[model samples]
Every structure is written in structure tokens, then in C-alpha cells.
Target: MAHPSLTETTARVQEIIGSDAITRIFRDAMSRTLRDAFVHSDGEEVFVLTGDIPAMWLRDSAAQVRPYLPLAADDPGVADLLVSLVRRQVRAILLDPYANAFNARPDGAGHAGDETQMHPGVWERKYEVDSLCFPLQLAHQVWRITGRTDHLDAEFARAADLIITTWQVEQDHAERSPYRFQRHDGPPTDTLTDGGNGSPVGRTGMTWSGFRPSDDACVLNYNVPGNLFAIHVLGNLAELATVVLDDPALASRARDLAAELAAGVREWGIVTHPVHGRIYAYEVDGLGGAVLMDDANMPSLLSLPLTGGDAIDAEIYRNTRAFVLSPDNPTYTRGTHAVGLGSPHTPPDHVWPIALAVQGLTTDDDAEKRRILDLLARTHADTFRMHESFHVDDPATFTREWFSWADSMFCELVLDVCGAGVQSTLDEEQVPTP
Candidate 1:
């Protein structure tokens, strides 16, 4: 059920937009993305799927609910829903800290054939680092905006400890970790190298991920964008430990790990581009090799500033922006309909709407922000809901028509451009780090 306050706020936002057509689109997107995708389970839990899929992703679930955090304070029902979702995520983490997605019920839900330990509740055991980071980011934002820590129960504390432990083990994956994954009869990008263990990382201080945010296996184990996201999430966990959990030992552990990863990124993640000067790499092996391209995913190199760990004007980030948005990056594409970033997981010449929104959110220039908004407004395929990725040549032919994460992101972008009244309370710092 939609909260009364949420409905009231939507009306105010429509007034601010001052366009009946755009306001109707925004309202439709909110209903489709935020309201329709939420499921109230039997155990005081909320399960959110990425849409057209029957499982919940830790990253996608968090992003789907994030636009409602600011409104949580105005509506008790909204706060309850957000808190319940946080609790559900904690339960999912306890089920398998390494698993990126989960089933609402244990019915052998996802990827039964993958060469990894399969649990009944696991949707897919592709171990992406951003999966762990996003839940913490959402939990932190809920507490920050609502001035409440009711979500920090004993289960949450246990989940936080498990997350930190898993990250530490992944930091030494070459010798200490036992996790490996393989998928048969799939594309090369769908499976890992070195017999299901990913490519060699040389044990850099940054943690290892079996997959990228795109659900494609990493060519190099230490994904730089994932590590940068870790740095931000670890800081969020540290604050939660000290202020909410009152666990100094856990806080110290998080701080120490964050420092080590930050140092590793500074030492090895930046490379000298012949044309763009110093730029951040997408993936790096400690043994002096790096992938230079960026994906259009949330944890991609181009999303660093929007993801909130790095400053927008930082020298390396500027250089990286120059590289990622230009012809240099393989995934950067241009066509008659649009020009933006894409990913290896999608068809050629397709651009992601989330990436376009991230570019607008991160840019300080009003004209550039407006331009990106215009692009988004034009490329919704007349559905008023964002897709996973749309064709650069034709907006009508897009991928993943029911993806709620993209729709939620588009809703956020609309609120920003329309200057919604409720959005006035939404501090930039309170935005989802994912």
C-alpha cells in the first residue's frame, strides 16, 4: 500500500514539475518501480526483485527502496517498510555473505547448475563486492535520514561482522579463500578463469570479486571500482559500529580494512593514459596489468563521483571522465537516438539509462544536467519507465522492460530536475552510495 504522505508528496512534486505529461510519467514510474515491485513476506520482511525476475538482489533491492528513505520520516508506514527491507537484507547476508542475490523462499530458486555451493535460498552465487556494499549503504542512509537505529538489532550486528570477515578473507583470496565458481556452456564473460577462481590478483590489499556489477566475470580479480565502493561502504559500517552498535572492536576492524584498501587503490589502481593523463582503471592485477574500459553499471569507473566515495573534481576522476565518455572506452557508444555508456552484458550499441542519470547527478554544470535530462525524457520508449538498456539507434527496442532499479534511478533523476518539495530534505550526502 502506498503511504498517504508519499501520495501527498507526489502531488507536490507534480506541481513543481508543472508539466502534466511529465508529472504523469513520474507518478507512473513510482508506481511501477517502487510500489509494485515490493513484496511483503510472512516474516515481517520485504522482498524486492529487479522486475521480471523472481529473486532479490542485494544491490538492486537496496537501490529500489532508496528513493523512499527521505519520505520515511514523513510516513510511519514508509519507515516500517524500509526497516523491514533492511532486516530482510540482513537475513539474506546471514544466509550466505558471498551470495549476491536470494530467493524470497527456499525453493531452489536460481542457478542450480553453477559450479559453486548452492543453497536453497540463493538466486545466484556470483560474488560481486558491490552486493555487500549496497545493503550497508542503504541501512546507513535510512539511519542518517530518519534519526533512527531500530534496524540495528543483534541480527544486523552479526551480518556486519560476517561482511567484514568475508571481505578480509577475499583480500587474501590467493592463499586463504576457498570460494570458486564456474558455469558450463556459457559465454566467456559468464564464467571465471583459472578453473572457476577468477584471474590472478597477486593478493593486492583490495578484496577480490568473482564478478563485476555487470554479472560478467572479471578479467582481473581486483576490480578497482568495486574496491573504491568498498572504501565508501567500510566507512559507513565503521560509523554504524561506533555510533549504533557501540562496538569499538568492530569499528576499529572496519577502519583498518578501509585504510588498507584505500592505500592499495592509491598505489596500484591509477594508470597513466597516453592521452588522458592519470586515469582510474576498471580492473587491475597487482602484477602490473589493468583493464582500461568502464561499464555503465553502478560501481563502474564512470560512476565514482555519483557513488559518493570520490570527489567529482578530483584530478584522476576528471581524467577518467575524459576517457570513459569519449571514444577511448570500448563500452562508450553513440548513435542516432542517444550517446552514453553500455556494458559487456548487453547487446552492442545499447546505452544504459542509469549511467546517463549518474552523469547528470555528478556534473556541476546546469546545462549539462539539463541535456542529460532531455536525453532521458526522450528515450523512455514511450513507456515512462526506464529499461535495463536501450538501443542507441532506436529507443523502442530496449532490454529488460520491467527492471525496477533503472526505473527507481530514473525517478530520482526526475525528482532532481523537477526540484520536488520532498526532495528538498534529501541531502546529497544521504543519496545511495551504490
Candidate 2:
């Protein structure tokens, strides 16, 4: 059989699923909007949005279109577009290593860049560590899937070094760096303390993250899932150094960092669940304190598999899963329209489609997937687009005018179920990579 373009495959799905079917809903959503959201308009950079946030969050943009890596590989135009996006992100880091978000083009507002502003788009600038981790993951994944390395250039290497330096500084935040954000528009409790600079902590091996992967402020000093992602990021860095750059020294450094991070997680990031007995914590301080519940975000406890953490011990993960999916987890919510998790970012009753898609992707039960699929299809409000979060009880009141990450993840989960080669990198990394 011949490989089909996304349109043809999507046509097949729409054929099987009524045009308004569960999976076809998101397929059509992306069909109408993804190109515009992702393609660089006005020749700026292509930093996708989450719903309608005008600013391009470094983290969100990378994860948003990541599912397209495979599809882009097969289509040169899309592949070129992704490469262009990566280059734009690399430029942002070079301009301001501290800010995690950037305006696709400089508006003379962010930290300073010689690069000219591309019209109709400007990079949003805010510093977040995980933001640096994402472009490497995207570039590496695109290269791995496409067998193309045209975009990996001197700037990427320079960005890698800047990331290393930034990471090192963050590891010792008590003394090294000076960065903070305080959003006065929201409630004082709704925002971070100390101007969002973060609370202080002891010198543990764990790296400091000003923001969680959720792009929100961290309550505790150490974020377990973010650290888990850091471990994965370090692994990818090593792979990129070796596979694409042929820089064994950088690869070794990344490997050492990954080891250090894993050890830190072992030391500070896990706890003994009475039920699971040895489940990981959401965030930790290495000072005998840990947050136990999970959120509905990527790098979430639920997304262990998607983020490259394996369920090596089914019984333990099963127990942990039961705890999270049940009433025990604070963020877990259930309603007539949807039943999943919600973060503080949304109203109490609202649930994120990202979480539902993740619930579908991570669960082993067909019934659970179907239930989630049902909720997802019903909650889209017939725009055929996924929202950042829907009112779990109501399924209507959603946020964001443009959200590309949810759209991408929804697409990836559907593709995975359809045998679209969305291979888990967990197993590939479990053993040594040659």
C-alpha cells in the first residue's frame, strides 16, 4: 500500500467516522487552522500559540507542533517550516538566554537582539528553563525522524552552550541569578510569591526551575516531573551531540548531567506511597517535603510515557495511577461532559483537552480511552478545535482563542491509535543507544 498524505489519511478517518466523529473532530480542526497557526505569517518566526495567547511561549510552540515531526518529514514544505521555527527559537535564546518566551521577531522590547523584527509577529520574552530544553527535543526528533540535519547549525551549538550555562546558574539559584516575574493583574495568591523570583532552598543536585513545565510558578523549589523532563532533555542533548554533531565531549557532558539529574530525582524527587509504595512526587525540596498530587499538564505524572519515563513496574505505576485517576489526586475532576484533571490555571470545573488526550494515550484500557474520546468530542463546542480547558461540568466555557499544543497532542494520540508510528522513545532510551 502506498503511504498517504495527511489529507488522504484524514479522509479515510472522516469516511469511517462521520465528519463529526470523535477523532475526525480534531483532525478537521487542524486541517482548517494548524497551517495558519504554525506557518510563519508575514515572514516572522513561527511560534504556535495555546488557544489565543498572542505571545509565543517557547515551551508551548515546540510541543505544539512536535507531533508533526513525522508528517513534516514526509513533506518538504512542512519540514522546511519546522526547521525555520527551530532557527527562530535558537535566535531567541541567543538574544536573551533568560527569557523562555520570545516574539517571533524582536520588537525592541525583549532583552536586546541585533536581529530585525519580522512583521505581524513578535516573540514574547519570559525566562523559563524548560523553554531551553524544548527546541533541542524538537530539532533532534525532527532530525531522527527525517534523517535530515540541515537545521542543526553553529547557532544550535551556541544555544546548547548557553543552555548549559543557564542550567548551571539555575542549579545554584540561591547565589547565581537574578530573574523574577510578578503578574499584578491576578490575585496575589493566584501568582508567585516574592515577585515570582521563587523561594530559597538548600544546595541539592537538583536544578532550579523558576517556572514549572505548566509555565506556571513553582510552589516548591524542585519540580519532580520537570526534573524528569530535564533528564530526558539531557539524554536528547547527548544524542544530538553524538548523532548530529559528532561531538563526543558534549555528549559525555550531557550524559553526566543526565546521571546527576536522575540521582537527584532518586534522592529528592520520590516518595513512598502507602498505596503505590514507591511512587514519584510532583515536586520536592529534598528536605523531607514533597507534593504528592499530579496536574493535567505535559511533563505531568500522567505523561510519564509521553515524556520518556517508562512504566517499568506496572504494579507500582498501576497503584499510582489509581491514586491519580481517583478522588485522591486534587487536580482530578469528573463531570458529565468530561472527566479528567484541571490545573490552577483554569477555573475549578474546567478541564484541559491536553489532559484528556493524555488520559487516552496513557491508559491501557479501551473503555477508558473511549470514555475520554467521548468527552473530548462532545466538549469541542463544534468548532472542531480543542480548547485549553472546558468546564468539566458544562463542557462549554473554555479558554484561549488559539491553542496549537492541544491540537497537536490530540492529533498524535489519534494517530498512535491508528498505528501512525508514534513510537515511544522510552524503550529506545532504556538501553544504550548506538
Candidate 3:
């Protein structure tokens, strides 16, 4: 029972995708990519990418199917599929407590330890708080976007508790937390120490993150941006605990942690910015050590608002914004075609689509948004498919063809162009910060 408007919209989408004309290329590009990336096999989650990589990620898989969530309310086909993806992610979280990515089965074709590959039902063991955090955001959003809360169940409560306990223990990395990892690729610097595992950081009031949101090792324990996000998410979790699930104890726990993370950010995350007066650092040691640069990752300074969090008016966000957009930030780069956030994971001067969209998402200027849209249109290398990162100079030489998150973010950008018309019924269900 497709709504008349959606029926019309789908037809238009099909026509635009089928038309081999240049004017409608972007629309077609998005359509073909969506078909390739969002289609699930054997009643499973959509593969976040194509090629040799074939599996779902807690983060990427949620992102892949998210765009179609609003359509599911009227389209039964999409609704059933969305529910399946949630079940897959819930099963993945339950599969192994510490894993960030998962597969559909144990004998999955992908390598066991590769952080990037997906083995169906087999979660690659990476202890990133972001991994757990994304599912909650996506699950809540899916319900909101489609008026479907069928996915929120007993398992969600347990997963939420696991996240809380993990964070609480990790706040004191010395003896309280029990997490470790060792990557064998990249460079020696990219690899962690103390037997490829990170050395313990001195206990700070803030929770210890073994890795930054980038999945790279944290030089300073309190990743300020992540702490900011923790405040935002933990605040949301506090409400979800009380209002959504009606558990006073869990709500209280979320509140305590939310308040603590905010306090920690204020007391420890801020640093003196000689030019901008004061700014937040990328990471802080709590004992005075701070890494004063930004990465091209979400939960990044630029992505604060994009993650559905409150704005940090602190001078440090402004300062860090300036630094991140400038050549001063190690990861920032400028090129002939475009200038934006880059990352260490990719080649030098490679711009990330996630970073670009975040900037567009957080920017208040319509002109800036349009500019980003055009760059993205041009930067997709005419494939209309978003890549993880592209050479700042050449758009074709990119990485990660099947990144559904980037594609969804690009769709979000297109929606933004038309007044960001994509609304989730879930947004109206916001419980409000108490």
C-alpha cells in the first residue's frame, strides 16, 4: 500500500535512474548505488559494500537501510527488511560483547581480524564505544522515521546496559577496564604499543577510550569530541531508559554518566587557543596533555550537530573548526577542485565524504550547503556513488565503493538541498532532554 506521493516519487526515481541523460545522472547514480548496497541477501542485512567485502556492520549496516526507513511505513517490502536489519544488529551485539563489526555466520569468507571487512554474523573484535552508540541512534531514529518501534525489545535494554557498564568501567582504564587490540597492518605508528595493545592511561574522571572515533589509537585518553558525543548520547539514553523503557535505575545511571562527561569536558577538554582565545582539543589526557588536531571522522568537532547533539559554543569548537579546516590541522587539506577535512587512514590530501557532509549538515549557511552539494556531485567521480575518501586532487582515485553510510549522507545532502525535506516520524517523538 504505497502512499500516492511515494508511488509518484518512486516512479520519478525510476525514470531518472533509467534516463541515460546527463542532466539526471546524479539521481541515477544514487539509484543504482542504492540498489547495489541496500539489497539484502537471504533475509539478512544489506551488505555495506559490494566486491569482496560482503557483510554488515553495526554502524554501516544501520546507516545503509536508514534512508528507506521513512518509506517503510507505507511500503511493506521496506518495512520487513528494516526489521530484519535490526534483528541482525541486535544478534551481532549479542554475538560477542566487544565486537564492533559482525558477519551472518562463523565460516564467513572475510578475514577474521580485518576491521574493515564484514563476515556475516561474525563481529570483528574492535572495542569502540562508537560501534555500540550508533545502533541506539539508528534504532531510535528508525522508529521515529517510520512510526515503527517493533525493533525496540528486551535485547535493546540489555545492549543499552552493556554500553553503560562498559563506559563506566572504562572511565578508569588502569584496572577497571579489560579491553585490548593489536592491528598488524598500516604502519608502526598506526599500530598500537605495549604488545600492539595500548599502554594504560592514568585514571581520569573521564572514561578511557582505547581508540578514537576514527578507530585509530588515542594519544590522549579523553577524546574530547567523543566525550562531547557521550554527553549528548548518554543524555538521550537517560531519557530512553526512563520514558521509552520505564526503568528508573537505568535512567539514573545514564544521567550520572551524562553529567559526569559534560563536567569532564568543561574541566578538562578545553584548552587555550592563542588566536581564537580558547578551544577544545581533539583529545585530552586529563592530566594536561592534549592533542590539538581534528580528524575527518564523525563525533568530530565538525559533526557535533550532525550527530543530533547540542551545539558546543565553547571557543575551542570554533578554534578547532578553524584549525580543522585549515592546513594547520594535520588531516585538513586543500586542492584545486575542493578543500575540506581529510584523514590519516587514507592517502595524504584525500577528502572524506563523511567529513564534507558533516560540515554541510552543521553549517547554517544555505550557500555553504549548496557548495558542498556541488562538490559532492563533482567529487563522486561521476559514478554518483560516494567513496570513503578521494584524492583531494582527483575524484576517481578513491576508496571503499560500498560504503552505505556515505551514500546515505549524500542522500541527506540532496534532501537538504530541497529544504532537507526528509523527516522521520521519529523526530516528532523526541522525548526532550529532562
Candidate 4:
């Protein structure tokens, strides 16, 4: 099979989607990352900027190019691009596994004033667990979709070890971890509590994360969604270690950690709500403190079906989904323009395009998916591209005019609706649940 050109792919998508306006938006979104956000270095590394930030986020960079994974199977060029990204991510993880974002060069750029163990190559050391998970997920997906193991080289093995050790240390964060962040002259969410140590957390087998995927400080350290994502990615890493690396020890370590995290989530992350029954909590402190509201971020409670894979309870997820999309979840917002999940990172009464896209991708209801897609098209504020977020009442009032991750997610959702969805490796394996 010949690799389809961008033009050919667009035409193929147009057949499924009859509307010309939507087709135009889809084409523009399909090319946005490559044209505006991607930077291929002379040293064969690919750095993807998170749109208007001029910095590469470990999570956003992987997601920005994910919609092109299907093309990578047939196109060597696309496959090479994905491989380069994995290489770059491996280097970034080796540089600082705790850093969420990095500079294209070791230029000492981005938030140097923040009180953390700052490195010249690191853009922001927010220390979100999802930051480490995204790279592994991308590498596994590339190999699964393209049958290429070139990205799973020696450096990746070392990085995988570091990631595992880091998570293990974080499982006992107060005693074993050395991560701290304190930003002066910023919002409260920009810095951690207890002199940058974050709020104290009781020992749960789940790993600790200082920040949410939204880059905001966590009220409670044990982020349920982030740990769920970590469990899924650990399964990916275990498969890679078993099949590609031929290291049974590493595979066993990954599986054991995954089981521990799964046990922690099962014991501490689910709560019996009066209205929603047994639903997953967004964040838990293992000390009877749990936040039930869902954010608009990728690993949010509303996104458990997409990120949590088979480990997620079907009936609980259905109940949780109902609670999150309704007025029950504090962040669930409805206005004149659209109704969906929002984030504390954004202003109040705003809806995130990424959340809308996730809603469309995770649902089996065709009408609901189409409704979310149409809502996204109507709320782009005439940019023909997705933004970070827009006001629920007024679509024009938005933030971050250029966000590549949001655009890529929109493209993925559109492809999903068109029945040409990108394949993901996260759902291929199930984490052992207690």
C-alpha cells in the first residue's frame, strides 16, 4: 500500500464528512503541527513546540504528532519523524525525568527564576507523572503501529529504568523524593504548599505528582487520573521490556509496580457518592480527602474510558461519566455556546476544546459525537483551528490562540468520527486490578 499524501488523506476524509466547512477545518488542523509546531534539528532530533510557548512539553509534543501515527505505518518519512521524537524524548527524560517541558537547545530558557533544581535544558520542572508516561506511550504506539523498534534503543532502556525508579521513589514521596517547586509572584496554583513540598500525603501505593496535566499544583498529591495513565503506560513498558528488550526482570518490575498502583487506585481513588454511587475521584490524599471534580485535561475522570483502558470499571465509568458531564462535577460548565468540562487552569465558565474532543472520541453515541464536533466547529472563534479554551457563554473570549495539542486532539476526534481513527496501544493490555 502506498502512503497517502496529505491531500489524498484529506480527500478520503471528505468522503466521510460531507460538509465543506468541516473538511477545510480538518485539513488545516491535520497540517498544523507539522507546519507550525514541529522543529526537526540538524542532529536528527525532532522538537515539537506546544504552540506559542516556544518550548517542548513532554506530554504535548507526543500528543501533537500522534494523529499521524496511522500514516507512519505506510510512510517512512512519517515513521522517521515519530522515531526522532522518541529519541528526543529519551534524551529529555535522561536530562531530567522530573521536568515536564524542555528547550530545543540547552539555552537556559523558560522559567529560570522558579525555585527548583533548575537545569539549562529544562523549560519547566513541574513534575507531573503524565509527563513521563507520554513518551513511553508514544514509543509503544509507534512500534505497535509501524512495527519499528528503532526507537527502543539503549538510551530508552536507561530512561525506562530512571522512570521506574522515579515512580518508585514517588510512591514514598515525603521520605524518598527530592522534588520541590516554589514560584514567586504567581497564582497559588503555580507553586506548591509547605515550602514547595506540596500538601502532605499519606502513604498510598500510588505514585505522587506535584502538578496536574494542566500544569497546576495539586491540592492532593495522589492524582488518580495521572496514576491511571501511569498504570496504562507501565503495561506498555512491560510489553516492550518483555518482547523488544528481552529483559524479563524489567518487565516483571513494570508489572509489579502497575499492580501496586492499580491496588492503590482501587482502594483510595473510588468513592461512593450519594447521587453517582461508586465513581472515581479526581485526586485523593489517602487521608480521607478526595476531590471529586474532573478537569478538562487528558487523564481526567471524564477521560478514564480513553486513558484507563480495560482497568476501568465499565459501570463505574458510565456513572462517573454521567456525573462529570452534568452539573454535579464543579468544572462541568454549560453556557449559550457549548457545554463541557473545564479546568481550574483556565478561567471559570470556560470550556476546553481538548475536553470536547475527548468527549467525542470516548463515546459510542454517534449523535453525541457529532454534537460535540459541531460545537467545536462553532466555537473555534473563526480561527479554523482549536484554541486552548473559550468562554462557555461567549466563544470569542478565549485563551492561547495557538495550542498544537488541542488542534491535534481535534483532528483525532474528526478522524474518529469519520471512521479513520488513529490506533492507540494503551488499550491493548490490562493492568492487574485488585
Candidate 5:
């Protein structure tokens, strides 16, 4: 059954958007996750699959349902769905803090052949920092938007502690952590280096991430964008700890960790490019190696304003944004139809709709946003749904015909342009200064 609120919201959007194509895509994208991706498990848990993939990625699931937050405030059904998904996420974290995706059942499903610590309930064992950060982000968002505390039960508190501990262990990964991942007969990015321990790195206060949000191995290890996202999420966890969990110790720990990561990023993440001036690097080693490109994924350098808000330096972000959107950045692609950020995860000259949506959401220019919206409306391959990536010159050539996260991102950008976007709870005061 469709949520009544979603039906009513779609009707309102139809009244606001003038283009028939835009309205049709907006309605489909807005309800895609509920209609196609969500799977109700036992009890109140709801497992949300990343479209076309049978597994549930912690980061993708959180993003797939985020556009529905505004409707969650007034609709009981929407609120319950959000709450249930958070509960499910908390359980997944407790199962394995290092796993990025999970199986709905403990049937030893997904990547069981990969060389790593594989659990029956885990879909993939690639440990990305954003995987842990996203669950906390969703839990906090659900609480903030719906004023619900049932999702933040004792189980959630336990999961929070495990998440913090896992991050702390990963801070000195060479000596303290025992996590390793290896895959045979695959691309180099599918596996880590140095006997599955990943590349070596010095002691930067920022935690080490074996993989990026793109599910590609990190070259420099200490991912700056992932750390920045972790810093923002720690602030959210601190607020949740103090207000709901009644645990000042946990709150202080989260704040201290956030401060440490922020200090690390300030010292090592910024690079003085000749053209872009001072801007954030994508990845860095404490010993002075940095990768100066961004991917088309969440927690990317281009998404700083959307995720970090006023916590980031406004002037530096402006410079960084200018660099990432231009040809200066290695992954920025330009063609006849669309120009946006592309990912190493996909083929050359293929731009992601997710990046375009993020670009529209973070911009201040109405004309720029409208231009992006028009481009998106025209380049859906007549499927009326967003795809993972499409050819820069031809919309007919695309990847992942059923990508739920990209669809949700498109819906979010459209809603923002229609003056109905949800405000992030990570305000200036809530986020730590970097």
C-alpha cells in the first residue's frame, strides 16, 4: 500500500513543477524506495536493498530513504517506516561494525568467497568509514524529524559503543586492527594492498578507511572526505548520547573524537593548488601523499556543503567546489548533453546522476539548479527513473537501470527546487569546526 502522505505529496509536486517529464520522474523517484527496495523482516526490522543488488548497504539504504523525511513528520506510516529501518540498521551494526552491507537472513549469502572475516549475516566485509557513519546519521535524523525515541533503545546504545570502538581501533590500523580483505581475479580496486591490510599510513588522528564510499580501495588510506563525514556524524551521535541515551561519557567521547579528526583534517587534508589555491584533498597519508580528485559518491569533496554545512570553511569550500566541477579535477567530465562528476567505479566519460543532484542541492544559484534539473529531466533514457551513470554525450548509454540511491537523490534535488526540502539537523553549532 502506498503511504497517503506520499500520494498527497506527489500531487502537490505535480502542481508545482511545470514540465510533465519532471513531474513524472519526480513522482516515481519519490516513491521508488518504498515501492521497490524495502523488505520487511521479522519484528519491526525493515531491510532496504540497494536496487538490483540483493544486499543492503548501510550507506545506500540511509540515502535511499532520506528524501522521505519531510513526509515522516506528519504521516504515521512514513514515521514507522523510517523508525523500522533505523532499528534494522542498528542491528546490522551490532552484527558487524566492519561490514558495509548485510544479508536479510543469516544464510551465508553475498561475497562468501571473498578472503576476509565473513559472517552469515554480512553481505560484504569491505570496511568503509562512511558505512559506520551512515547508520548513526539515519538514527539521528529519524529522531530529529519524527521526534521518536523508540529506535534509540538499549540495542542502539550498544551499537553506538561498538561503532566508536571500531573507529578508534581503525585510527591506528597497522598495529591495533586485525581486519583484512582480499579478492582473487578481480580489479585492483576490489582488493586491498599489503597482504590485505591496505596501504601503509602514519598516525593521522583521522581513522583509516580500507575502501571509499564507491567500494573502491583507497590509495592513501586516510580518506579526507570520509573523515569529514565522520566528524559531522560524531557530533550527531554526541547529541543523541546526551539527550536520549543519558550518557555524558559517550557524548564527551564522541565530541573528543570529532575534535581530533577535525584537527587532523585541518593539518593534512588541505593542499595549495596553483590554480585552486587552498582546497581539501580527496585522500591523504600522514607522511605527505595526497590524491587530489573526487568521486561521484556521497561523502565526496563536492558534497561538503550538503554534509558538513557551516562546519567547513566557506571560502576554502568555494575554491574546492570550483576545482572539482572544472576540468582541473581528473574525474570531472564534460560532453554535449551533461557535465558532472564521474566515478572510477564506472567507465570513462560516464557521469552520475547522484553527483548532478548533489551539485544542484549545494549550489546557491537558481538558474544553475534549474539547468541541472532540466538536464536530468531530459536524460533519463525515457525510463522516468535515475540510473547510476549515463554517457556524457548520449543518455541512452547508462549503467544500473535500477539504482535506488540515485533515484532518491534526484527526488531530493527536485523537492529542494520545489521549496519542500528537509533541513539537515547538523546545524553550524552541532558540527565541529575544521
Candidate 6:
């Protein structure tokens, strides 16, 4: 299936956004990452490699195409691309739910040595919980917005069951789980201590993730945000099971598991900071310890609302927000170009556009949102495309020259600010008929 040329897609986006300068920014940003990262095979498969790397991360592939879902209902080209990507993601998950990233084909292509379990199709086997959650999130979005469920076939149902089972095992990770990972040569964060299993957790009801969304090993196995996200997407899975798959038993299990996880989170996830009152921790154990810092990634404490886990206005969330965005949080950085959060995965003093856009998306303050937009618009470093992270003091000096997830998120922020309702452009009369 041939997609619309870049020109046509840009024109459609521009027509929807309705702001000349902002549309130009969106067009340039979307064109670079979306056009470069995605590819469709001669078969009924599609693949989306992470920017500058020829591998598809389950987490990234889901996020990189999210901004297109609402638009898919209107644009056949966008719709086809997203639908194909959904099919590809379902195949990857069915291949291995424990594997976070995969090669385009069953060829020995990536990270062949850092061993937990190796598959020819898998690029890296590091088990980040968000990697599993993201495919469900994307599938849910595609179904809700486009009303297309053909992609939700038998294999997709099997993958959903696998995810629930994995989470159930990880709930008792120390005893029941078999996943382990070790990287001989890399940064300290890349390798887990205690041989391959990550730091110990005390069965906090939350599922264990061996790695963070940054692909860095977790200091505490039960990542608070990831568990929160699991609850949200598990609910999504429950609905999908009942409505799409028509399996009430599977739906009941998902709902019960989500409720158990949420109960655990409420018990151990919230900490009373002296300055911030009750707030969410980045990572926690069922024991007493908690990491009171946030990274500049989705599923961070700052992104609860964005992930559909919690409302931004919830009291504890507001408290967490203040702590996450303030200088008191060790990862929060203030530079000449921007003031936002950074991650250990990148260099010091670099701010992620993803964090900034998420802030704008979750905030109700118009002025604050505009301020974030101005910072994002000005920091594209003359390329008119978003980068992974820019130097806190110097926007031009950035990392990851081509990152589609960040680019897609920036496009989402643009759509929000420009008052472009998600499906507004796809109204019956406005949609082009072939």
C-alpha cells in the first residue's frame, strides 16, 4: 500500500492545525521522524525502527505512532500506516512478551551478548514493563479512535494473556519469576547487581520491571510509575478482552489483577515528603525504601496523567508534580535554554523535550503551556525537528539526532495548543473519499 507523499500528509496536517508558522513546525517535525523511521514491507507487515537505530522497541514503536491515531480516521495514508504498525507490534509481542525490542526480521542483528534469553528476532531482551504496556496502549487508542479492531486477532489475544501472566509472576518475582539480565561491558546502570536479577523487592503487589523506560536497570525492582501504568493498561486489557475478544474470564482476571496492583501502589507507593506532603516515588520496594526522584521519561512521576494512570489534579499527583519539577528533585535541571527533568541515560544537564511537552499537556495554565511551547519551538536547534535532549544551557548541542518518539510527542503538544481536536479534521464531510 502506497502512503500519501510527504507533501500531501503535511498539507493535511497544516489544514488541520490552521496556523501557518505552527503548521510549518509540525510539518517539518513530523516529516523528519515519521518519514524516516517507518517502513512497510511487501508483505502485510510494517516496521518502525527507533531513530538512528535499525531496531524496533515495543515501547518506542507504540509511542512513535500515537500522534497519528486520531488522524488515522481521516487520512487513509495515516490510517494504513498506523494499522500496519499495530499488526507488526502484535506479532512482536506474540513472539516474546519478555523481550523489549526486536529486529525487523528473524535475523541475528542486535545486542547478541547481554544475555537473559536470546531470540533471533529480538534486538534486546531487557524486560521493561512499559515495553509490554505500550502495545496495549497503542492498540486501545487505535480501536477507540478509528473503531478498527481487525488487528485484534487471535494472536493479539494470546499476547494480552501472556502480558497478564507475566505480571502475575512478577508480583512474586523473587520466588516465581525466571527473568534475569546482565551486560558485561557498559555503564553501571546498564548491568544489574546480584548477578542478573535487579534489586530486591518485597512483593509490593506491583509487578517488577527489570529495566526502566530508559533501558537502565532499576535501583528498586517495582517501578512505581510502571506499576501505575500497568494498572491503567490492565484495565484497558480487561475492556479489550470483554468487548473485543468476548472473554469474560480473561477480563475478570485483568480487572482483579489491576485492582490488586492498585491496592499495593496505594499502600507502598506514596511517601510523605517533608516539603511536598504525600507524593509518588519513582521506584519503591514493598519494604520501606523509596527513590524520591523523577526521570524525563514517560511513566515518570510527572506523567501520571499522560499515561491515563491518574488525574493531574489529584491531590497526591499535584504534590508529586511540585516535587518532580522543582530543583529539589536531583534530576530536575535548570539551564539557559530550558528548565525540566533529565535522565541518567543521557548526558548530564540535558533536558528532554518529551518531559517538557508532557508538562504542557498536563498543565491547565495557558501561560505555562505557552512558555513550554516557546521553549520547545526555540530549541529545535535550527533543524526544525526535535532531538532526544538538548544541553540545558545550549539548545543546539543535543543528543540522538533523529528520535521519533520525542518528535511525535512534540506534534501532540502542538495539536493540543492549536485547538485541533483529535478527530475534528476527520468529520464526515471533511474526510477525503477515494
Each prediction's total of clashing residue pairs, residues at least 3 apart in sequence or on different chains, is: 0, 19, 14, 0, 0, 0
TM-score of 4: 0.96
As for candidate 6, its clashing pairs are: none
Please provide TM-scores, in order, for all candidate models, with all chains considered together. Answer: 0.95, 0.87, 0.85, 0.96, 0.96, 0.93
Tell me the lDDT of candidate 3: 0.66
The lDDT per prediction is: 0.83, 0.68, 0.66, 0.88, 0.88, 0.81
Runs in model 4 deviating more than 4 A are 1-4, 424-434
Q: Give candidate 5 misplaced runs (Cα > 4 Å).
A: 42-44, 424-434
lDDT tens digits, residues 1-434, model 4? 12355667789778887767678888887776777787876765988999999999999988888778767766788888899999999999999999999999999999999999999999999999989988998898888877788999889999999999999999999999999899997999999999999997999899999999999999999999899989998998999998888888889999999999999999999999899899989999989999999999878888776677756888989889988988989999989998888999999999999999999988999999888888888888888889999998999999998999999888888778877677442234333322
Q: Which parts of model 3 are misplaced by more than 4 Å?
A: 1-34, 39-52, 69-80, 108-123, 311-316, 421-434
Question: Where does model 2 exceed 4 Å of error?
Answer: 1-4, 15-19, 39-45, 108-126, 189-191, 310-317, 424-434
Our model 3 lands, by Cα RMSD against the true structure, at 4.1
Error of 1 at 316 (Å): 1.5
1-434, model 5: which lDDT tens digit per residue? 57888888787777877778988887877666887799875664889989999999999999998788878877889889889889899889888889999999999988999999899999999999999888888888777777788999899989988888888998899999989999886899999988899988999898999999999999999998889888988898998898888988889988998898899899999999999999999999899899999999998999987676445788989899999999999999999999999999999999999999999999989888889988999999989989999999999999998999999988888778887776642221132222
Maximum-lDDT candidate: 5
What lDDT tens digits, residue by residue, belong to model 1 across residues 201-297? Answer: 7877888999999898888888888888888878888888888888889889989998888888888888999999999999998999999999988
Model 3, span 67-92: residue lDDT tens: 56555656666776676667667777
